[model samples]
Target: MTYLLEYSDYGSAGLLIPAGLVLIHLCALLSAFHSLQHVRTSQAAVAWVVGLVTLPYLALPLYWVFARNRFEGYREAIRDIGKEHDQSVTSIRRELFSEPCNQPRTFQSPLAQVATVMGTPVSQGNKYRLLIDGIAFFDTMLWQIQSAKRYVYASFYIIRDDQIGKRFADALIERANAGVTVRLLYDEVGCIRLSNRYLRRLTEAGVDVHSFNTRQGWVNRFQVNFRNHRKMIVVDGRVSIVGGLNVGDEYLGAIPSMSPWRDTSVQIEGSLTRKVQAVFAGDYYWAARADLPEADWQRKTDCGTTDSNDPSLQEEPSGLGAVCTTGPADERPRTSMMFSAAIGAAKERLWISTPYLVPDDAMIVALAMAKARGVDVRLLIPSVADLWAVYLAGFYYERKLAEIGVPVFRFTNGMLHQKCVLVDDSLTLIGSTNFDNRSLHLNFEVMVAIEDRAFICEVEKMLDRDFANAKRSNGSNRPLRPWFARAGTALARLFSPVL
Candidate 1:
């Protein structure tokens, strides 16, 4: 009777607000149920449920964008064209494994589990050079782009329209005009500021360029957060550069705010380069929806004169390595598992450097457990934060790990952007994977795992120099974060699932 009386008093026109509220709550209930069933982490599930149940209006849109753990569109697209990709992947694996991985007498490859997860094989006879800081950022990479004989392929997360970008554009335009096939794939979200004039200049020169649009077609309209963060370039499917440095003035340490911009990338060649090329092909296909017919799969990379007399150009044939490409499209959490495996495999010392350090609980436990086993585990994060939320959250994790005897160092020499890992004397990895939830779960990432003693030493010495410039902190003497930063830590935890 009261409901009827109120409806009559308000008339049909006033029912809109109440009707909308009922529908919103109903939708919230449905989303809450979905959260309970689909969310992988129990804590995240509970948080989502509580938020959706109490505040549906605000939480609904966020849930729609961030709650999805799987990249359904990427998987669906893969299913549409997976046959060719799978066959190629299988063929590559057989070719890689035909040459035995030269394992040490006692040490087994710790990356075996990672290889299984990525469905790729570790191959021998590969050569790699660790490119530290600005040494190889443009000097070597640009030279290779200029030296392209057949084709040039470049993919970056972010490309500025500044001086370095123009130089890079000039190289590709020159190559394309010379009848050398040139293609570029850049992340749309990362390169949102990239002007169309820059792209037009390349296209006018016959360069094929496309953005890796996160939201493509109807199936992917809701996936706004997934990003292609892989930074790699392959020339003629022979030589490749894969790692943390993207094409920008900041990457070259020219930007005053981000100067001395500490970063690392590697120029690798040999059979392993093919795997890197294939990974780019997959992303390029996703972006352009076409086969890269020009990619030379049959030709093996000759690398740098392997016989060069010049000291800077002389690089030895590396032993064994594999390229692990991972993303939200994967069935399992491959990036997190890969990092965990590396942590678990460290028998002597484990050192890692990344800009952000907000990892999940499971990864935290893995790091602490490694320390318990007497492994000299150390973490290097930036003293100057590039992303404030991620940096503040690192303080929380740093204290947590320190309580369990894992010390973290804050790199004081400008900003530390290198994503590197050193495991024992023969194992090391470099690429664009950060030790954070974003890289572990949300973003598309690629890492090169090398089991070459010579290359590993190069990485170790580089990190040693970084440690020398960083400040170490353990819970014992480290000061607590600011009271306001507690809010940032909470914010980090709340968004880490989707961030």
Candidate 2:
């Protein structure tokens, strides 16, 4: 009787263990269903549903880490803020640039679609200078900050607490101490390694500093996928800088292994600078919950009038440009639309350079169509990767694209960090946006579209030099990839919706 009783207890305990596991798996399936309803893409939703049903223990944790897409409360906050000051802001901006011929001619056909998507009208009477590398870019930027007379607004995705970071901070501090009304914004996730001491020093010197806090509300406590990836600096409402360079020693090419980091930036002066400043103002309000007082929000009485024969106006045609800013807060996917339109408009050639090349279905289709129609499509990606998983995943796409006659090249000189596109020989798009899902659907990004012939020629020459040094791939040259690496890439691709 005692032996039978002990056997009964063992059986009951074993049954309980199975029951608990069943319950846990049931919960995971329910979460997966929720994801299917909320995920941005059908591919991601189906992947999550299958993974959760088959491998709950592994998929559940990853889903929680990177599956969330909607930036909770951010869209509502932006709407509310705009409602509070929409008329005043719009009227003030109009009055500030109230001059004849300030409005650029509406772009025809496909480019017009991009203008509508961006919601910022193309402006005339703006000048631009392309900065090729980090050293020249930073030198010009620092000098402009030092020369600020009224105010300065600067934002970067990553601001490390290193040598270059200190130099940037010191420059801002000096301007702030001299009563320049300096404001700085950095991404909390991108600058995760930044020390509190570094920020405290800036605050002590009277420079207002804040992080682009995507985790500000309770509902967003676990939402770490969204990022502010824009790099912009506007000084005195007259000069602005925008591009891919971030604040760090790596950007300066100080690390020997990754030395000669290739990048691009642009400095702009004229009416378009105000538009950039306006974009900064919106982001600043989201970060600090306060308006930048020195921003030129009122009308100017001395706005320049159009004079075609004027020496100043005839000297150059670099003033034809538009600013496009997009993020998760937008009602639609503006960044993706912008890229698609640019690709569709390409008549002769489309050259692109980015560190990452993980394209979604829409972008892939766009590129394929461009190639089918005889658009000379070429892509430049880094031969050596800083992230192993990303590197492996890119191989899949590179092979697929090359099969369609889209020539892809790997930069053997060093890391190609420039996010730029040359559409034919008439337009150039440059900014912090990358050709990946993260930039397309989950980050705050800014891009400038320029249609100046002279500027495009200059950018073309620069890209030609880069292409001469890169190695062209025929798509059949991939080395033997291990089974484990192949598996890792397949898994990594499952998370590309948020990567």
lDDT score of residue 167 within candidate 2: 93
Q: Which candidate has the highest TM-score of all? A: 1
Q: Candidate 2: where are CA atoms >4 Å away?
A: 1-30, 54-58, 82-113, 298-318, 477-488
In model 1, the clashing pairs are none
Model 1 residue 174 CA deviation (Å) reads: 0.7
lDDT of each: 0.81, 0.81
Lowest summed-lDDT stretch of 10 residues in model 2? 298-307
lDDT of 1 by residue, 406-464 (tens): 88999888988999998888688899999988898889999999988878888888999
